[model samples]
Every structure is written in C-alpha cells, then in structure tokens.
Target: MDTLSFNHTALTAPNRTVEVGGRRLAYRRFGHGPNLVLCVRFRGTMDSWDPLFLDLLARDFTVNVFDYSGLGLSTGKPSYVKTDMAQDVDDLVTALGLGKVAIAGWSIGGIAAQVFAALHPEKVSHVLAIGTMPPGLMVKPSAPLFLQTAFKPENGIEDQYILFFEPDSARSRAAGDASVARIASRSMVVDAITPPAVMIQSVIESADPTTPFPDPDGRYQAFYRSTDIPVLALSGDHDIMFPVENWYAMNDLWPTLFVVTWPDSGHGPQHQYPELSADLIASFVKNNPRPV
Candidate 1:
C-alpha cells in the first residue's frame, strides 16, 4: 500500500458521524495505510487531539479519532466502566469495517484500549498506552489538589496547563498553548464538555478500591503475558497525573512491554512533543509486524 503524505491542512478537517450499536458516534478519519484507532482521554472530544501529532501519525497510517457515545456529537448514555467503553470502541470499529487495527489510547482511554484488546484480541494488531495508570492499580493522585480544581469545565486553558503541561517549564507551557491554538484553528465551535456527573461517575468507577482486574491475580498481568500482541507504553517523566512511576510499575509486570518517557512533560506528552511522539508511535508499529 502506498503511504499517504502527511497533510497539515487535514488537521482542520470537519468530523462526521456514524451510527454504531444503535448510537451515533462522531469521528474523523484521515490519511491512509494500516488502520489506527485512537481512544481519547477522560472527558475528551474528537476535536481535542493535537493537529501536529495527528498529522504525523496520519503520514503512515489511517488514523481514526472519535468521541465516545454521549460525548461531543455522539448520542447515547455515557459509560463509566472501562470495559463498557471498550465495547463501544469495538462497535465503532466493526461499524466502520476496520479490520484488525492498531490501537492507541491516552489516560483513561488507555485503560479502555487494554480492555478492548483483551476482549477482542483478534481485532487488534498492536496496542499503545499513553499517560496511563497500571491496570487494576489504584494509586493516590500524583497531581496536586489544585490541579483537580483546575480541571473544572469552565477552566479550559488552566486545565490544559495543569493536566497537560509541565508547570515550571516555559517550553512545555508554550507547547501546550500551541496545541490549544492548533485545536482552535480547526474551529472556534467547541462541543459541550462531558457532563460532570458522567465524569465523576467514571472517576469513581475507575478508582474503586474493591474492583481490580477481573482475574484472581488482581492485575492484568495474565492477559498481557498470554497475548503475543506488541504493547507500547509511553508517559511523561514529569507527569503529575498518573506519573511515570505508573508506567514503570506496569513495565515491571509485563517485562516485554516497550516503554518511553518524555522529559519535562506532564499528562499530555504528545501535546508537548508532537513530532517525537508521533515518530515513536509510527516507528513502533513499523518495527513490530503483526503475526502472519
């Protein structure tokens, strides 16, 4: 297959909607090659992606970024359970006729990706988890309390600074600003933020102490161990939310996992270093061939 040339202009392309499993899903598909499905972070919309980052990935793969049901323009009840969200992704993939795709997820989306891979192992060629906590591990919040406050729906800019950019690093802050600007260039029209009730429910469900992995081992180690699918885990060294230590812990369990950490970045490493992050993901997929 001929790889599509990276097009910066596509970053501002409009999104379309498709019905999946009786609910409408808002999505944008660009570039061409092997399919790559991106699951967004908590309370994120399809427009939330950084243009430069998406453009880079689009150079080598058909990238599909979509909003979860009930978020953005998608219509349905929101799901708090990671597994349920994963199923939604599966439904969308099936609806689009995207066969055996490479999957990447950020933050809570990473958790959903893992579940999706586990539940539908035959459908995934590879898995990439970014700025995610270890599966089934309920750790204390790595970010400051004020950072949580900054995540309020009305505080979009501040939320980006606190959640995505490294606080003390001017360079990282500038990158965050640039990403926000790039997103803005796509459209001044912003979708309604995910409802606080849904967001709170998701947070509570994800962090519930009594609920770990479904298996007896209390972790997803068995699932990772048994699967031959390549897994790449990436995070920011300075990430205040789900810190790099979380990746380290996950790596400790799955020794075969490929891991990387961006220096001086926070929760959103891709936003801080779009070029490098895109290169890393594209390279990983190229290097790890799917089984014949």
Candidate 2:
C-alpha cells in the first residue's frame, strides 16, 4: 500500500462510496497502517470530523470515517437502535474487505461500537471510546443549565462551546474555538448535515437501549463485562453532556477497563487536545497488541 500525506483540508480528501447491505455507504480513507475505523458523534457527518485530529490519527494508522446508512451522503433508512447501527458498521467493514480492524467511537457512536465488539468480538482487536455513556445506563440530569440549552440544534456554535469546552478556563475556550474552525474548514454545506428528525431519533435510541435504561435486567452490564477485547475509555474531566462520572460508572462495572481523563476539557477532548489524544490512542494500540 502507498502512503499519502495527511491532508489538513478534509474537504480535499477524496470521498468514496461502497455498497453495504443494499445501501450506498459514503466514506473517506486516508493515512496508512493497520485499519482503524472512526465512528463519529451524534448527528456528525463524514465532514464534521476535525481535520487536525484525523490528521494526527492518520499519521500512524489508516483511518476510515463514514456516513451512517441514511445520514450524510449515504443511502438507506436510518435506524437509531445501537445494535442495528453496529450491524451497519459490520456490513461496511465486510464490504470494504478489512480484516481484524480496531475501532474508535465518539459519543453515541461509542455505544454502537460497544455493541459491535460484543456481537463480533473476533473482528475487533481493540476499542477506543470517547465522551460516551455506558450501555443501558440512564443519563443523570446533572448538566449545567447552559449546557442543557446548548443541546438544542439551533444553538450551533455557542452550543458547541458550552458542550465541549470548560467555561471557566480561557485556554480551554481557545482550544474549542480552534476545533470548530477546523470543522468549518471542511466546507460542508447544509445538505451534508444530518436531518433534525434523524438526530432526535438517534438521541432517543441512545438513551433507551434494548436491554432498558439503567439496565434493570443487568443484561447490558453483563454483555460488556464478558467481552475480553482490550478497551480504552477516554473522557474530558469537565465534560457536561456525558460527564466524567459516566466513565467512573463504566470503570466500576468493568474493573479492567482502562480510563483516561484530560483536565480542563469537556465532551470532545480529542478536539481540544488533538496531539495528546492521538498519542494516547496510538500508544494504547501499541501497548495492547492483538492475541495471535
């Protein structure tokens, strides 16, 4: 395989499409190394990813980012169920002919990634989850009022700042500003945005898991605890949407899960501290080689 220079400009990266489960799945493949799939955040399109972060990850591994079945340029009906979404990811992986890939999931994508790992353990070598809540856990209503308002779709940039940056720190605010600018640099048009209906449905699906919210049956908890795949859970200490406490809950349930929390950061630590986040991810992968 030939190595290509990491493109700082995400829009310039060539967009490719593949047929998966009778739907057209759009994706961008860049960087070089063992295959690593990136599952994007809630309502995030293929272009919404931060180029700097992607570039950093691409430096060490071949990164694959794509649109969900009905989101962005992809074609099909969008299902909000995490298990179904996980199947979609598996279909795409098989469609692309990738063998034994690693995966990093952000926010809701993290939930889907967990499901994927549980369902198809043989196909996944490692898992990286960021700004995510544990499966079947009901989210506590502890977000600050400002952060709550920020969750609205119309809030836009201000919402991003509230959700992803530490409001009390100037440095954190600046990092948030730069990350947003990098996302805009992708030159995404309105058509590229995920539909409001789809976003709402996805959010609902995330909160209401198949096993039940709060995992009253304990089945969801058992599923994750049973998985022996190497897992790394990353978070921002100041995260508002999915607070740092969420990571603690996950750790409490699965004592073996590795956890990393960045100081003075919020929901999107990978964007706020791209270099550190990327280095941690690379090191984790390096340290935990797949069993032969």
Candidate 3:
C-alpha cells in the first residue's frame, strides 16, 4: 500500500496529493494498520511535525499529515477559518477513500479537529488534541510571549525553546532543541514553510466553528459535548499557549474525554517525548473503537 516509504516511517515518506472540492491537498502517508490523520499547528506545514513523533505513531498506525488549504503545499483559497479547515479534512478524507479514521490535531489545528468531529461524527472514530484549549472560555489567558514569538518570520532553536518548551528546565529545553533538529533533519522537505503574512492572517483571522448539530436545550454549548466520540487531549503541564487547566475545568462537561499532561513541558509535549506520546496514543486508539 505504501509505495513511497521503504521502511514505513514518516521521515522517508514521499509527498502525494489528492484532489477534493477543487482543492489539491498535499499529504504524506506511511506505516501500517488503521488510518490516523494529523493536523498541524498555526503557521505549521505538513513538514512542521517532528519526525520522531510521526515515525513512532507509524509503528502502530498508518499516519496521514497534511497542509491546510492554501497553506504550504495545499492549493485553494487560503483561509484559517475553523470551518474551512474542517472542510479540508472532510474533503481530503473522502477523496483519499479513508473511512472512519482517527483524527489528531495540534495547537489551533485541535480546534479544527473538534469542529470536524462535531460535524462529521460518522467519519471520525477518535479525536486526539495536542497542546490546545477547550472551546468556550479559557481558565487562564495565554502567555504574551507566545504571540510575540509566533509572529516572527523565522524561528531558531532559541525561539522554539521559548515557544514550545519550558526555558526554566534545562532538560525540557534540550528536548525541544532535539525535536526541532529532528524535524529539520529530513533530507527531503515536501511542504513549504508558512510565510509571515500567512502567519499573521492565520492567527488574526481564525474563527471558531458553530455547531450545526443539536445540543442540550436545542442550542449549542460546547462542540465536543455534542459528540459521544472519545476525545483525548495531550499537553504539557507548563504549556504557555494553552493551559491544561482549561481542559480540567471542563472535564465533567464532555461525555467522553481524557487528558494527559507531561510535567516540565510546554506546548509541544508530543515533541518533547515522542515515543511515550505515540505509545499512549496507540493504546488509547486500540482501547477505544468507535461503535459500528
């Protein structure tokens, strides 16, 4: 099934495209087992994810990661609207003939994942949200440094340390550096880095999706609450961008939800501990199968 990757790992996987709704979605797929579609963060391309994390996930599942419409390699009217992102996911999945697949998203992409699950419950089996806040209200505000660092045209190891890792912890900082290096170690990069203009618009113009499905009182509350699908959110205890506390406050709200926060870590816990994160995700997906 995988003609591009010889070892079934994300690192060596070649680029591919699938046309959907007039949009050419750029994607890469490797490994074996059930399908897992991953969505990247703000200003992130398909090349943005750490290969260590992706390769680890590939061990247990067929991993699919892609660029959003008009970002990176995807061709379409560029937008950061949550509904448009959800549409991208739905169109790409249907175009690729992937049915009932598990979905994972990081940062703002997590919001896109929630929207997708709420709108297309039949197409999704499990939802894995990494380093993202729950919908509605945030228990605490995000760190100002996040906006400062994210708006940069290019990020170096130091910027990454500030954005994704706990600078106070030498261990966490080192882990962040290693993760960044691994992502750059790719011999072939299929996706383009998102430019500064796109980054600014993506963050500023992003909109949350409203539920078209019914909820309690015949009105919408939280999108995740509208679906019975099992949702797992992975985060760092010290995530400056999206605090894990917000997720805890809404723990009792969602019908089926789980959270995992790694200590001394920041926004990208999956990157800091790729193997452990991947293993936990594999166990979660294997244990929770969507009702047929």
Candidate 4:
C-alpha cells in the first residue's frame, strides 16, 4: 500500500528542559487552544504521540506532549515509580506556566494523571485517562492472551502493537505498527550495544512504583471519593495494558465520570480514531470550561 500525505498548517514548536526535583525534563508544545498537556505511558517520548492525533487536537486545543525524565529527550534514566514522573509532570506544568490545564495520560501516563489530580486538584481542571488502571495495578484483565504476552518485560517492544494493530489489516494501524517495530528494534540494538547498566538503571527506577503503586486500588478509591473535578476516562475494548474492566471500576468509584469505549480499538483510540477522539475532547473542553 502507498502512503498518502495531507497538507495543512503546521507549527514547529520549541523544546524546553526544566529542572524538576533536581532532575532535568524535556517537553514540546504545539497547536493553539486552551492548554492541553498529554503525558505518554511508561518509556514513551513526545514522538510516541501520534502526529495525526496531535494535529487534530491542536486544531481545537494547544496540546503539550513531552518525555518524562529518563524517557525520550528527557534527562535521567527510566524510573517505574509513578510519583517521580508525577513530580516531573508537576514541574512541567509550572515550567510551561500552564495554569489549571486539562491533563490527559495514556497507559501508565494515566496513573500519573491521577496522581497529579489527586495531589494538585487545584491546578487541574479535568482529567482524561486512557488505557490505564488505577494505582495498584489492581485492574483485572479483559484483553486476550496474545496481548498479555506482548506487554511483558521480555517481549521486544518491536512487536508491541501487533496485538491490536492487526498486522494483516491494510490500514494505518498496520503501517504504524511496522514503523514502531523498526524504530523499537533499532532502539533495542542501540541499548544492547551501549552500556547496559545505564538503561538498566532507568528501567529499575521505573519499577519502583512509589506513587500509589503498591496499593493503587485503595488509593484511587480514596482519590475518587476526595476529588470533585470532572473526569473523562477513555478505554479501548481490546486494550491489553488496561482493559475496559478498569474503566468500569472507575465508573463505580466516580459515577459521574464520562466514559467512552472504542470497541474497535486497543490501547490507542487516538490512533484508531483520531477524528472521534479530537471531537470528543474538544466537546469535553467546551462543556466543562474552567471556573472563573
């Protein structure tokens, strides 16, 4: 299949690194609407965000995406503890001077979003959590077996998306899956060639799970009871990382929570349905403007 290119107005946003809790973190901005910050999942970079999705959201909101410390362009090695990353997010919010912004996260990014909202509800107007579970990894399974194996630590990131992208399909998922595979494979080779200790340290740090990790379930339950802010939780019916059941649990905790399930997608509704995602998000923002 051939690739098609669409032309549109583009902005080359600048990158900035700021000190957050004694560590440097990198970030970038684009689009032009109310401030919208997107935090990627574990080990994700700004590049991990789908360009098309960002462009669409940018049409309606000023979208900010960045690498947490130890990921992508950010400083330090990867750390699993969500609290540290949450602090990085807090610092990013301060560094960008984005006051009371709508915060969104994917996968583990959602966990960080939860932490940020719980810790600084005053600074967050709304929360959008996608493909994520509550704090303790207590979310139960709804994804298939193949996907479970795909996300395991040993499974090469190169094959991560195949579980949902449908390699046989001729759509963008297949193409994107291939692209990610190539990039991840190359990344693995680089890690293999470089000093393994540095990368290992990052991975170990990420594994610490200091922010609500050991007991995310109980903590999220408490956060739900405590938070008054509106939340929009989106999940893919096929997501292996965090399944639809997690969303159900969240709804049980926060009955008023706005929930959307992309029946045809897994883990990445933004990629599977960019227009729908953008429209829903824009409408969410319009309906729930910040208090004056």
**Could you estimate the TM-score for every candidate?**
0.88, 0.88, 0.92, 0.78
**After superposition, candidate 4 runs with Cα above 4 Å error:** 1-11, 136-139, 142-158, 163-201, 208-213, 290-292
Q: Of 1 and 3, which scores higher on TM-score?
A: 3
TM-score for model 2? Answer: 0.88
RMSD of each: 3.1, 3.0, 3.1, 6.4
Q: What tens digits encode model 1's per-residue C-alpha lDDT throughout 51-156?
A: 7888888888888888887777888877647777798889889988898999999987888888898889899999999887666654545656444653465556
Error of 4 at 187 (Å): 17
Q: State the lDDT at 280 in candidate 2.
A: 92
Which residue pairs come into collision in candidate 1?
none
- lDDT by residue (1-292, candidate 3, tens digit) is 7556436577778788898888799999988888999988888888889998998898888899998998888888777777788899999899988988899999988878877887788899999999987766576878889879988888788889888889899999889879988988988656776677876776566643432111324222455665678899999999988989988986888878898989999999999999899999999999987666
Task: List candidate 1 segments past 4 Å from native.
Answer: 1-10, 138-141, 144-147, 188-198, 201-219
Q: Tell me the spans in candidate 2 whose CA falls farther than 4 Å from its real position.
A: 2-11, 138-151, 188-191, 201-216, 252-255
For this target, which candidate reaches the highest lDDT against the unseen true structure? Answer: 3
lDDT, each prediction: 0.77, 0.77, 0.83, 0.67
Q: Please give me the total number of clashing residue pairs in predicted model 1.
A: 0
Per-residue lDDT over 1-292 for candidate 4, one digit per residue giving the tens place of the 0 to 100 score: 1011122222245555777667777766667767888888654666666666778888877777777766656767566566776787888999868888889998778888888888888898888887776655545754456534543554454355544443334564665564454344332112112133444456565564353255635766677665777788887776765777766776766744778887656777766666788889889878976555
